[model samples]
Target: MAYEIMFASFTFFSIMRYLITRFTIPDAVQHKWRWYNVWISWIHALCAGLGCIYCVSIEPTLLNNLQDYDIRFAYNLIEMSTGYFWYDAIDVGVLSGSSLKESLILLCHHFVVILCFTVVVVTGDHVPIAIVCLLVEINSIFLHARQIFRMAKIYDGPFYTVNKIFNIITFFMFRFVSLSWMLRRVILDRSELSIGYFILLVTSFPLMIVINFGLFLQVLAKDVPAFTVLQKLQGSKNQNRKEKDACETLNGHMNGTHQTKPVMKAEVVSKLE
Candidate 1:
């Protein structure tokens, strides 16, 4: 059943990728590849997010017995996500033009997730914990939608702002609050957990916290007024530096010194443009 679900998930994502590429024209040529990727991601987030909710709704007891409870449907959902991560890791790392840095970060994340999920599927233990971790996907739906909106050039306006609001709210609720609660539970239940589960939780939770916190900061910098003010100040500083360099270059040209090096534009400017 796990194998069947994994295969079905891989095939479904593959079809989504093909259909998106064949039918949709990206708003910008540069967004062509990311456009396909983000749409597929949005679909996966929706499925996994809602699937987690339904699984928990039907099996609320799983939360009470996190160690030993097993739900076939929950395992199927984990398998489904495992398959999607495998597909996305391949798509981002090998098939897409993602930079080495971006690819490595995502690949590392996928590798950890696949490893953890594979253990649960193989051992048939910790299914409930897996589902709890997957609740973060609920936040990811908004995260991916934000990317979709950006790629489609829908930045300003009520809809985009509303999505951003939801993104921040969900990030706090699902990603931050849920993980913190899970971490507390894990520490409290350490004696009951197996050595393997203990090690996995100890290692994976910290890594996840680091990654999620980084993402949270990025979201805040983009959406929060305080961070936006800091960003504007940083931009102003970069602009002043550029102007200073230009003036120095002009002075060198006028004096026939030929010593002033050309100023390289700030990388932030290139990314924004």
Candidate 2:
């Protein structure tokens, strides 16, 4: 029932988002369809993320006892989060029009999240893992904000600079901190969790971290050196082409002179006469 409601809510939110962006912000819609989707999804992720964090923190889930977290609220929260992941996997892939490889990565990510969390929901155990996974959303908030700014054409402004800084900081903080905590939990408390659940939790957690780290490196590579190395490479190519064109022009002129030299004096003399 929780899953059904959350799924319906996400579906409704997507439809309403499309309508509002299409009608209300027609300009952005016309120009940045992908951005429009990002903006709406960002809102959804933020809300769901905050709800998970609040539920996890307040509930005695993370209060030094993993097996003691059999609360219904946390279960419902994870279920909702799984629905949101389902929505994101489909929506982002369809809307972003990303490359096949990129789309697959995201879809696989969503698949893992939904599958693992669904297991936890069913067993009423490993709720802590679901909560930790949602911590990535803390970083998502700023990351999505940065993407929104870029799509809105505000990337060159001061606000974007601040947003980018926060994005990076939050990314490192949440990703590293969450990963470390999970690792510690796995190392010290392995006896408590079942082998199957432990395997799923361990595998899914590191997979997300690896994927996120790869994406972070891509961002650094594309955005940082793009302004410097790519520009310089382009300039050098243009310069070399110009030099080649100049040489070709000189050679053409010399050939023309040689062909015309024998007849030019007689032609000019006849015309003068």
Candidate 3:
């Protein structure tokens, strides 16, 4: 029941956002601010909330929920990207006054940390999976902070700085807390940390990554023919409906059940002719 409710809410939110953007909402936000801080803050809440819920819920580790919120979907019930995820691309470019070398180092560290984490999963080593995830998350938060700092001057007042700082601190704290919970779970019972849990973690994370990356490339290549495909599909449906209606009419008439036209007197028919 909880799963169904969450899935429905997630889908509703996604559709509402899309409709607003496509039809009702203006191209610009009312505050004339980019959603950089808002986006990061959302991630923080998602991680913390899911982490909490996992501990509270009677299902698998809140990691499922964590992925949903982190992946920007309340649920990954669908295999497609569904526009419920982050809109901005994974930006690598840092702002002015930021050292290019440091950015590269952070980016490389991000990849390396995640790679090690991946290796652990592939080798079925859940022990260090939590640790590696923590490291990678920290690197990711640093990269975001770096960009935010560089872009501070471009922002109005000190709003960006303050909000970004909050975002960073909250992000770090949540991830750390979440990691602690996993560690405790592992320590409490080896059986509690079985391959079943590991498999879910391993399978879901990679699937999300692959699906997201593919969507990114599809968007970049400008080959997402969703609307065109939809139009073609609708046309086919309409054609099929028309044919079905014709068939029904033909069957009714050929079965000698009714006249094709209204009956009239012979004099009236002769005059019309």
lDDT of 2: 0.73
| Backbone Cα, N, C clashes tallied per candidate | 0, 0, 0
TM-score for each of the candidates:
0.81, 0.71, 0.31
The lDDT of model 3 is: 0.41
* List of clashing residue pairs for candidate 2: none
Better of 2 and 3 by TM-score: 2
- In the range 125-211, model 2's lDDT, one tens digit per residue, is 777767766777877888888777766556566787777777778788777777667767876898988888777777877787888
User: How well does candidate 1 match the true structure in TM-score terms?
Assistant: 0.81
Give one digit per residue, the lDDT tens place, for model 1 in 13-97: 9999998888857546366778888889999999999999998898788766667765678888999998999899889998897
Error of model 1, residue 152, in angstroms: 1.2
**Candidate 3 per-residue C-alpha lDDT over 66-144 given as tens digits, one digit per residue, 9 for 90 to 100:** 2112321222221111112221112233321335674554354334434433333333344233332443234244334
Off by over 4 Å in 1: 230-273
At residue 220, give the lDDT of candidate 3: 26
The global C-alpha lDDT for each of the candidates, from Candidate 1 onward, is 0.85, 0.73, 0.41
